[model samples]
Target chain A: MSFTLRFGPVFEAWRELAAGVWLTLQLSASAMLIGLLVAVVCAWAKVFGPRWSGWIVNVYVEVIRNTPFLVQIFFIFFGLPAAGIRLSPDVAALAALVVNVGAYATEIIRAGIQSIHTGQIEAGLALGLRPVQVFRLVIIKPALRAVYPALTSQFILLMLSSSVVSAISADDLTSVANNIQSRTFTSFEVYIVVTLIYLVLSLAFAGAFRAIDRRVFSYPVAR
Target chain B: MTRFPSRRALAGLALSAALAVGLSARPAAAQTVDEIKKKGVLNVGMLVDFPPFGITSLDGKPDGFDADIAKELAKSLGVRANIVPVTGPNRIPYLLTGQVDVLVASLAVTPERAKQVAFSDPYAGIRIVVYGKVGAAVKEPADLKKFAVGVARASTQDVSLSAIAPEGTNIRRFDDDASAVQALLSGQVDVIGAATPVVGEIEKIAPKGAFDTKITLREQVHGIALRPGQDDLMKAVNAFVAQQAASGALNTTFRKWLNTDLPELKKPAI
Candidate 1:
């Protein structure tokens, strides 16, 4: 059988694809930022906070990490509505991404925190630094630097997995590609272009993470 | 810093390359009536999930309107009918790749599809309608602006609804009919574009008098599909359809499945 690859239709719908890319970027970037904050708080709670708070953090981390991301998004978008909490698709996608990545990052950051010697905290206190400042300047910065590579890789995976958000009608890149494919019946061309676009996006994210690593975590540490 | 084209990036590129090769490799062979007779079985592909038109029977056999038509077609060809269950999206690929000799799948006749396969004259018809909650005041496409509409993305109903929907109409396109129907039942959408049979399925599951058809979107006719260039096979299939339609045998099957007389089946202009 002879088959011709027509990329004309895919290129013609560049605007929709562009919009999809923008939405994916927005969802990924915001999720990464907010998810990091959530991870930091949860990690602190697990490693140093009260036992009850640590147990709650453990539960949250376990539930999100063990379940599939698709089911998480479905629960937020479809299941939550039955409980009287309605969210639009984009918002739901963002929420699911944040909740998901937060759990994984919490575990990663907690591992980094556990690696820090308790003597380091005593030294910061001996030097007259307050508890909050010690936690921030001495503990978190070094812990985060230790786990930066792992955390960023997870963020990149989160970006790729955002494609699944299209299941709930989030107009992410894959959803837009699907809409175009249905209209044109150019499945091969559409997916090829989408695959390339995703590759570029992940590469771009990896580059950005590398830059952050250089700028923020390159400081000389006291032995 | 990691090197350019990291390991993960290379993996992604390799996966995409593999997918390209998989998709472009076509092993379709042209089938003829003689080939089917030689095999002594007509491999008829029909959807098992699309109820009334195509469905799995209580006894685990393929049984529905399309299945009935498929059996009749095989009988006319003097062969045993071997029904192969297919889904809506993959039905065409099943026919084009000769996985099945022909598709009595509930494939609607459309110009877009004519490029890939030859369609026999339509043997069945379905009406697409805007079904909604009983209290929603949706009378036409314009009124949809005030409502959230759900549709299976890229379906005929999606195309028709998108064309007629007023500006600012919130159309939620789910992955398939089941998802769209779920959206409606869960109150995620105020209305949904669906087929009459799907509406029937919804009625069977949803509370009685909870929802009703608000407006008809369009009527679509389904045709038996064969790989393109099978002129002899196409002729035979069309003759069978004409004979069945004239003899009222098609109507009997339609009434049995849908509980209503078959709507007029006309050859759509492609």
Candidate 2:
């Protein structure tokens, strides 16, 4: 019933929410860094490895994509302890995010590598380039350029999805918002402030990725 | 360019506008207690899994202390009690939206909560209790200084723990009490802080002696929360509680749901 806008205390709440945003950024960045490593190996396996290896990657992607993120988080954070592998919330949340994002990135990077026509590989061979060099210089870099936009978007989605970790008790922005609302009893206002903070953080992440894209793929390529 | 309005189009627009006005006006008309009684339904909100206090049973029926009270309140008013299941963070929102006429959930009567909703007389007394790892011997709140404590999001226990938490203590929060229990069971945290009944429920769910009881932080009153400005409805509920206490019917209802003897039930605060 008390609808007066308490901007002073509300701003104090926003400050706490800012701290949560920092934690969220830390979670998303680390997950993406680890996810990038997994994506590279998985994409490479699907592209040049044995038939069974490709099937393994396919199953991993399908299973992760099919189940809800909430279930996957519970299985890692709650279910793992029963089998004696107990992990902290930060570690569990990070592992879940990386596994979930890696699957999506695998498909995107695989498509980019596959789109490298047969003639491109043959041309590299004709130029006396080794298989590894051809992969590094031609297949990998250009394919990366082709999928840059998709990868950036996936990372942004990963940032957004990281909000779910609040459920597992990661002291991230959304979880902090819950605490602040309980204290201030300003539920709607608290969520609105948190939403705007996420918007700014997402935009900042997109800008940083754009800068990285320009530095990594200076070559003229498009998909 | 202007499009010509047909007779049928005008009629359709009028009907839709009238429907919108009618739906929006429902809550406004429902402001009075007599109107809510005339509608023959008393909407009540409760969490879906808070056992002994409020819960959605395996058969999908509400089965708990608050659930029983809702039913009794409805019967007293000669209306059906329509229960609205809510989450930890959504209880106040449900009340504000007029989705439920009363929130009979295990809601702590905090000053912050009082600002958003009016509460009837306190029905239950609750305290925040801490449960540490078995054999940890954390005797006091200050004893947790060297260890991490876990709690649920947006809970009274969270508030109490944070207020008196040691400077270097690590306090982790989960979405609900179940997850906090999971963290404690998994050894992710050294202690779990929550309501007393919740700690009891956790013991029932987990292995024997998995957790040891610690200090109680603060005692608080739990009340049936109503939307702000619903004075008449508040008065009616207060009167019913008073009559029930005088007739000893409230005590019977409490024993049936709580399954324990609470001497406090004999004295209805109303």
Candidate 3:
């Protein structure tokens, strides 16, 4: 059967879609920043910190990675309030995304950290660098530079994953499309537009990550 | 302007109904009933996912109150009922664009919807009732002032409750009826605005009389819809509804599927 395409109603509701897109961006951006800190700390502990800290980080990573993102968000948004910790939708979305990405990113960053050679550490130490300076200048920068591509892709996945927060009524792009399609009864048209919008958004995030990588990690190193 | 169109259409409907009474040539557009009779099959559009009102049986045929009604309406038209699956978002478009000859989609008769199609008289329906724990003492809308009530956001219950709730009433809106009912079951909300099907599902697990309907917030009447200007087909559908209501066939369908007597219904005036 041939289906007719209708885009007029979807275009007319640009205001709602714009608001939803703004919220999705804010949620993903906040979660990505906070989650990166979480990953770096956890990865460091897993690599060079006390044995007990590594054990604790291992438990967290395992629990989050084993579970689904939908369940995690549901737990934070609906399940946690019963334990007397109430959170608004936006806050819950941020917490869920951070927790989910934190676990996955921890493993990715840990791989980067493990790739650092013992010789590089010795070189920094012999150069009179303190333990902290040696770790920062010799360990973290190159490790991050090594895994930068993988890390950016994970963040882009997190941005797309932000769409799931709509189940908790967090007013993301998917939820706005749902409301519009229900109202207009133009489901195919509305979803086609939303799919294109999400495609453009993913591409934009990829472009931004590339620019950030080039600018921040431009230092030369001996091969 | 679904509302405005129907108001205007009602005036036009009266003239057409009268003009066709003595005329040999029917309006060219209002000729679906003849085409369907010529084909000897009535293509009835309905939703299969809306349970108790609409569902696909394990046998791969549509079953439920709407499905039963669609079949009976087709029988009256002297044709075999061919059920065409249509979702909530597409049912109206499916009918208007001639993908289906008629719709028995449990379509709620609203002014907004009335502008799109001609509605048969109200045959069967559902209600949004405020129900909760036995001791909550929420016997009416005013009594809801002291308790937190949950309802699916942007649903019929939400609109009805919001329109009448007192200034201090704590009304929580969830994403769906299940979540709203879950909020009630968990004691997260004292009461919920839910439809009969949800209440029926809840009754299967909760203790007898654990929660009861304290007040009915609103009732939505479902009507069989045909493309607008189909005066002859609209008359036939209306007569079928009246016949089913009188013969208790509609109530029998309601009890068979919903396990409750049919909700009282009258032709809505919007």
Index of the highest-lDDT prediction = 1
Sort order, TM-score high to low: 2, 1, 3
Task: Report the C-alpha lDDT of model 3 over B1-270, residue by residue, as the tens digit.
Answer: 354567778989998988878363322222456877888888889978567788889999899888999999999998999899986556876787677888898777877677667899988889878888998997667888999788765556766788788887877656666667766776667888887787877888788988988888778988898887778898889889999889988899889998888878987897
Q: DockQ scores for all the models shown? A: 0.54, 0.59, 0.13
Candidate 1 accuracy as TM-score: 0.86
Query: What lDDT does candidate 1 reach at residue B109?
Result: 84
With a 3 Å backbone cut-off (N, CA, C), the pairs that clash in candidate 3 are: none
**lDDT preference between candidates 1 and 3, better one:** 1
- Per-residue lDDT tens digits for candidate 3, residues A1-223, read 2346879999999999999999999998899999999999999999999999999999999999998898898788778877887776679889999999999999999999999999999999999999999888899889999999999999999999998887676778987887677566677788899999999999999999989988989889778
Ten residues in sequence with the least summed lDDT for candidate 2 chain B? B261-270
User: What are the chain A TM-scores for all the models, listed individually?
Assistant: 0.98, 0.93, 0.96
Tens digits of per-residue lDDT, candidate 1, A1-223, equal 4668999999999999999999999999999999999999999999899999999999999999899998999889888989999899999999999999999999999999988899999999999999999999989999999998899999999999999998888899999998888788787789999999999999999999999899999988777
DockQ for model 3 equals: 0.13
Candidate 1 backbone collisions, by pair: none
Please give, for residues B1-270, the per-residue lDDT of candidate 1 as tens digits.
776997999999999999999877643343788987888988888888778788888999999999989999999999999899876555765776667889998888888888878889999999999999999998877999999999988777888899899988999988877778878887889999999999999999999999988999899999998888888988999999999999999999999999999887887889
Predicted candidate 2 versus true structure: per-residue lDDT over B1-270, tens digit per residue? 998999999999999999999778555325567887788888888876676788778898887888888888888878999888887777887788677888888788877788788888767666688887887667776788878798877777888888888877888888777788778888788888877777777777778866878888877777788887889888988887787777877677767766655445222233
TM-score of each: 0.86, 0.89, 0.71
The model with the greatest DockQ is: 2
Error of 1 at A203 (Å): 0.6
